[model samples]
Target: MLNIQNTKLFWASCLALLVTSLSFGIRAGIMNQLGIDFQLSTSQLGTITAAAFWGFPLAIVVGGFVVDMIGMKRLLVMAFIFHLAGIVLTIFAQGYWSLFLSTLLIGIANGTVEAACNPLVAALYPENKTTRLNHFHLWFPGGIVIGTLLVTLFVQLGLGWKVQVAMMIIPTLIYGYLFSKLDFPVTERVSSGYSSSDMYKAVLSPLFIFMFICMFGTAITELFTGQWIGLLLKNVTDNAILLLTLTTGIMVIGRGFAEPVVHRLAPQGVLLLSAIFAAAGLYMLSTFTGNSIFFAAIIFGIGVCYFWPTMIGFVAENVPKSGALGLNLMGGAGMFAVSIYTMFMGNFYDNLIVKHLPAGASLSVYLKAPENSASAQALANAKNLAGPEILQATLIIPIILIVAFGGLVIYLRSRKKSRSVAL
Candidate 1:
């Protein structure tokens, strides 16, 4: 125990993240309705969904650089402003473009939460950096779980998804009140006397550069593949919907065990192990058959469970000089991965259709073809052929991560031995 008295602030940060998660779920639940109302295609709706992710890099990078200067309190206040405005805008959105802009604002607000509070948690619990960060991140998937239930409940009760979206305001306001009343401490970077230029330089440092590449691979492996779980497993098992839920559940429970793991293995050790499991699990997902599908999915779930938070923990722990900027860049890399790879995979899928399937193949995929549906049928066949390969391609990402993280572990061990000899 670090004798932490500011637990209220930590809980408030969780609340803020909870609100963000709720917005994410609510929007996803309502996408079909929004599409109907706007007469937008699924691809267009995907663009709306992407805005929530793509906006993260900009807000986090800028906020990370300035967060120490303004302090967590003001940075949180900025997040609150954007969150409030974005939520309100989303509620009143009339069409595709408006929804896009509103969600973009929400994405920025979401990134602000990560930028401000990750450092706050780090500064608050110096000895428990990995453990506390893991605990703090539980709210992300935890919030998603709760938000999904809220969306389902509201929809079941014949309430529109807006009602679920509106409910997030309660948590948002609660966090706002808690944060407004409290005083924030200085960031780890500031207390350590790292100047702005010093922090910026830390990001470009060779060690940080390696960590950046590792984070990029980690993000793509975990999230990029995750986005396509349903389509990838559509034919493998009938539990496609439950598959995502299962993965998220495993993540929440896995993080609960992070403290013990961090104590034993340390951050690099944990990442090295995580990469191994992730690589093995993705292989299982790409090739596993029979009753082993569930088994493989579980393995995959546990594999990625520790990745995102641990990566952040590693950067904050080892690259302390980079401060909030370091964590910011790390998170930025992940979000960028999600944004870019979604497009990349979509392109790959389309190319697969062009390469393998015939025109008008998708519309009559399983049923009789309506007139002028040859192109749609072609798309369906392409998805069938391409989706699995996209998933299998993700195995390459984790394989890269294994090598990168393995090297980091060796380097860390060498440095530790050298420090011991000097001592």
Candidate 2:
């Protein structure tokens, strides 16, 4: 029984998530720096980005099974340790291989945060699970807002990017201190006598299976697009930080207002509308730029804003039998999309650049790009064409989601009507 008002615990969890979101913000800001420092191609940076996702599924899938037994505190402790170590490692990273390993560790820490906190919040406010999840997730974009501002601040101060990354350590330490002694309720899964085998059966059920599939598209649409925003806008804008901040600011407000939205649209209705927004937004982004860019971003941000939380909320409400494992599986499936697509998109962007190069131009010559000259202009041209092409390719994901979510809404509405008629 969560009889006590553990407001501290809730805030501690949010702080931890803020660290995760801040890490994402910092990374988005520094991606171009990393590319220049390492002299990496778009695809190679994709591999580095992909590294951050490698451990996500590993931790999340397993964390679901163990979170009940080991407790959220211990998992959070693990996250803190990895978070600290990963930051230190990232600060010291020199090349692709080093960055890859460090990001992989940080990815594990990020996954651990989700694995621990999702169930913690769900357990904390069982009466308002979905609403609280939406509220809790507000920090993801909020942290981005903070991070974007911080990035802008740090750049204005003429500080190195390392200082920006090191700044995350302050919150990381604060959250660790906050969670050091707070008591946690064992998940509903354990309290209700649900077994691991039962969890397996629940998650494997047809309804959950459909959700697992939807998670891939939804995660790809939101995260893949969000993470790559700076890179995708390389040619369109000299500074994308404002655009990134504005888009996420819209998301934070959207999530903040989720309670009313949920009452009005229900989760499925919101998702259906969100899919339409994401599809249209990405499609427009693929083809538009300059004056039209901000409008497209608003459309897409609104589409993706509700996706992660609503999907988590849907499963928690509708698939109670699967318990924390259900949330874990869904979360893991989403990360899995990042792991695969980051690499694929990287390679896709790289090939686009290569294919766009002048006829009879040696690929090796561009690979060893000349710092300043016609060679530089030619390379810029390749990237300009490649960036938008990559966005165009991602449209297929939301297009598929539209049909899937559309079917689910119809089926759920029918189910609701049947129950009402019976009553």
Best by TM-score: 2
* Steric collisions counted per model: 9, 0
lDDT score, candidate 1, position 98: 87
lDDT per residue, candidate 2, 1-423, as tens digits? Answer: 345546778899999999988988888888888887887877788888887777777788888889988999999999999999999989998898888888888889989999999998888887788888999999998898888789889889998788998998999999998888788888977777878888889899998999999999999998888888888877776766677787888899999999999879988898999999999999887788787888888888898999998999999888877988899889999989888999998888877888889877764578567777788789878888888888898999999999999999999999999999999
For all predicted structures, in order, the TM-scores are: 0.87, 0.96
Model 1 C-alpha lDDT per residue in residues 1-423, reported as the tens digit of each score: 234446878888888888876776566556546755676644565566668778877788888878877888988898898898888888888888889999899999998998898899998888788899999887776666676566567767998866667787788888888899988889988888888888878888998888887887887777665555654565556555355556667778988888988889898888888888888888887777667867777888788888889989988888788998899899998887777777666556555645666554442242233434875455555556665677788888888888888898999899999999999
lDDT per model vs. reference: 0.77, 0.87
Q: Highest lDDT, which number?
A: 2
Error of 2 at 291 (Å): 2.6
